[model samples]
Target: MACVVALLAAGCSAHATEAGPEITAGPDGVSISIPVQVTVGGMPAGDQVRVWARTYDRRGQLWESSGEFVTDGVGRVDVSTAPSTGGTYTGVDPHGLFWSMRLPENEQAPYPLMDADDVVVLLGVDRAGTTVARTTLRRVVREPAGQVLPIAEAGLVGDLYLPPGAGMWPGVLLLGGAEGGRPDPAYAALLASQGYVVFGLAYFGVPGLPTTLARIPLEYGLSAARWLAERPEVSGDRIGVVGTAKGAEYGLVLASTEPSRFAAVVAHVPSDLVWPGLGGPAGTQTSSWTRGGADVPFLRSLPARGASSAAPNQAIRSADAYERAVATASRWRLAVARIPVEQITAPVLFTSGDADGMWPSTAQAQRALETITEAGNPYGSALLDFPGAGHLVGGVPDLPTTRTAIPYGPVTIESGGDPATTAAAVRNTFSATVELLRKAMPRGRG
Candidate 1:
């Protein structure tokens, strides 16, 4: 029951090696969002065992899980939950180290888990950390039971993944941030595996879409929502949106403006108020979005370059950007850019990283929480803030959490965050998001 996850160098004893272990996972195949039950059996009764797993991402970055747990009277352990005898967390925790593993950060290979079918090796050991048994699990890159259709009509360029069952499924509009190419299919596929019809939506940075994250019309998002609701395979009353970063800003606006169309929203690394266009230096600010040919008034963040002094807006790569953004709270709260949280009748789940270098996501989330409370929103709101985690907070948490100095368009932006904390944040947000969606959009499954 005293499970510890820190590095340890202990020896195994012969008495603790009576039988090897057998590991198994449920709901079929390695997937995300929905619960994947992992269980271990064939261990010595009334004893502890260490669980370990390793998987290499597409770019060859390694992700792992190492934790300790006690066996039941019949010699079994469920990795999805803490053992009754010992562990750092409790009560069906999906974010425990046993479930969501972490890998060391590699500056060279910052992206992980973007590819399909990454094989993961799971091992069970004794108290001394001696490898007693091992098995392999394939993280299914795509749901075999789902169908993906190309969506190019109505100026929307993306893929729509539908679960296999004939029953009307809850629909989710998934949006990525400014680093757009195609809406991430890996994330959308995983969500589809969990019985939801997910549309990997691309509003910009794709063929037939804008080349930059500038002056996007909010009606595009509204159209996507309406399209998702109209689909025969989707539950019209149970459609929602899942967005991160700039996409999160759009989601908040969409939920507020089209409250009746959405049942829930999950905004990962969200802002409390709309922000100005992402291109260019300070003073030459522009709107990031528009509606009906009019600009959606947005607040401005300090430019990363071209300022007389870099102290105010140069936090793009600063280690203390998270702290500084919160410190300057009074300045960013422009009444013109404030999103009407009260207007959103659907419940919202906001996830932020406290150490985010790109922007003040935590502070903005706090402002959102306050706004929701002040408005007395009947549907309510929730925030998941991770300390030491950086700007790369959303998407699937299974990806690498290394700092990437990649060129996002013409500018090179730093995606800051530590490996361990970012992994934890991903797990926390993913689980919470699924729960929020399920609660908000409850439809019968066939």
Candidate 2:
């Protein structure tokens, strides 16, 4: 056995020793979405050892996860397959440490509004409250060979990610949710590393865009699509759009209105009808979108029933409000507010969670699918409805899923779903989306 010396800062002697515990991490580095295999050895047989991880989030704040496990007969703990007895997460999970990370006690931090940069995680092995071994792991968002270019021309705001060694890659217009800012590029960077030209667009809440979600012009989305298609690095004919929540709603509307533009569509926690905008003035009712200088018809959110006793920071589920509005909407209003998904010419993939606390995404996705089917649309469409999962249904796989409710502007929004199930749904949905994109929009080498 090779002698391994613990860091002097960890209160260990400088001299190398073979008797102490040792941690080994494989692949040294990987994309943020990939999992790393971790094993701790050289410990007392059947003894309890704690494996802890520490990393800084995009905001440079500390985030961490730890698990206590009993070593095997041979004094080995394989984190990749071991069932965590207690700590930040429970059950057997390969990416538990990554997805179960949380802020330190009583530390209040805002939810990250931007994509995380490369993450460096420090892993330590604690035996009887003493650090015995440590190692480092690198998680990257973009490949070294890739390039990111900011787009602010033609009334579009976004970041275009070019794949490494690409000829002309399939283009993807990535959109964010009701948060209304530049779409986080973490997912786009990962997709770019996998050979897609992803444009992380900011439709509103920027210097050049609208200050809020109210009455935004739909033509902005179409203009962004047209600009992306014109890019030399993008295969104009093979373009797709991927959006989450309000962004999903926007993407569907765009595809429906301009059926020939998008070759593929992926909507996460999608809506079946056009709904009112957010972040507007108090007691104001306005459509979320507009086209050709006219306000698009939309369903207004019903008034909150009564004052709630929930704390300010507590997560509040808004799904009930949406359900009530839909149930009470008049036939004329429903006809006008419903998204004409049947007009979409491209293949569509809808992902939703039954437990979506933000909205009834599962029901809405089902309605959209039914609309297309009844219209006899030639293009195929499918829905991935995950039971028990919440509104946070899709994204880069293997990040922290422990927090279902997070601070959004002033109030905390409860996205629903527990950590483990939501983690699984994220992984599965991401894989399915990639598979669909590869098939529907193939990349071409330059």
Candidate 3:
């Protein structure tokens, strides 16, 4: 069988002669933030065909997935919409192969990490244990039209993503969770591709910054926002903040304290109450945030009751600890630790997963929404809750989600949620986030 492969800027397509099967995938290359269409043809009707996907992460570790499906009456299968009869994932999910990818049993990495801006996936089709057709898909986190610039001045460390051919654009201060050391630019670049000036800031865990989350000043975020607003390409009046986990807590505090600076806020797996910082010495209490050189009141974390230690590989469910902490906190502590959502002027968007293992994000998010409603804030707020998703609900959509537990120091951390539900949550959360930002901080505004 003669096979021809054609590559395009966005993705690749392949075709085989009547003697063999054919595979087709398009736009040639695509943003990792979106889904791709994949179809296989020329197989015998009702015959089993195995479709496989493989990609090398930034660390050169291979991640792969495969599914077996019976062709339709027309001898074709649309992988995008077809239900996998048996494989790494079941049901019909357009991006199932991507999210269900897994590393080889011998591989040591906890999960596939796309450290680079893009990755190339090799997709193959096989029949009767023989390969028939193959193609390649290029997934990118950053589009060619976007540019990334590192920021180190003004006592700040971050990367700024500039949209293509920009007039004044809405600005977004992007913040990450406890992993710290400058947020990854992948999501910011994707946002930049959508015409926003995104600054991925790092408050700690990097040089010239705090080595840990303890006592990080809230003013630091304000300073970063001010710097972002002052950018010539940024519309000062249309600036917003997007943060996840601990960063979400920080963003909420910033939005509440300096309501005039931010027009929109997107918090993912957020905490309604401030929590203590990490990386401090044992038995020491330190606030994760501060303002005007004073530590902010924060809910203290309690020790895990050995429940999480029962999991294999010493993977701990951090949510249990958080739940205990909240349940046992003094009334004064609860009152003081709760974020003053009423003080926020911008419309807020909170996304949480009910099954999040890192913390009780769903309950906290609901509490925040209730507070917003009670405060009668002129700018309204919204929440997007996913039933079974985990703390990894935020970020560029359509990436691998198979690894719900990841290594954290000597032990593993259970993030909760299965791959399919988490993938769905991530996509929906991303859509809602973009919608909120566009509506609250419309472009072309001076």
Q: Candidate 1 lDDT, tens digit per residue, 1-446?
A: 23232212222443343555777665555564444666778877877777666666567666665666778888888876654333323344444543345455332443324643434545445556577666665556576767889889977888899876678888999988877756667778777777798988888877788887888898998999888888888876558899988889889988988888889999998887877776445468678889898988876555444333533323236324334434565654577778887788888999998877677788888899889988886886888999988777776655545444445544445666765677677777877888888888877521
Best by lDDT: 3
TM-score for each predicted model, relative to the true structure: 0.73, 0.93, 0.93
Residues 320-420, candidate 2, lDDT per residue (tens digit)?
88999999989998998999999998899999999988899999999999999999967778999999998887887877776677666667778888777
Candidate 3 at residue 365, lDDT? 93
Worst 10 residues of 2 by lDDT: 1-10
Query: What CA RMSD would candidate 3 show?
Result: 5.1
lDDT of each: 0.71, 0.85, 0.85
Where is model 3 more than 4 Å wrong at Cα? 1-19, 106-112, 307-312
TM-score, predicted candidate 3 vs. hidden true structure: 0.93
Best-first order by lDDT: 3, 2, 1
lDDT of 3 by residue, 404-433 (tens): 776765566789987799989989988899
- The global Cα lDDT (0 to 1) of model 3 is 0.85
**Quick one: ranking by TM-score, best first?**
3, 2, 1
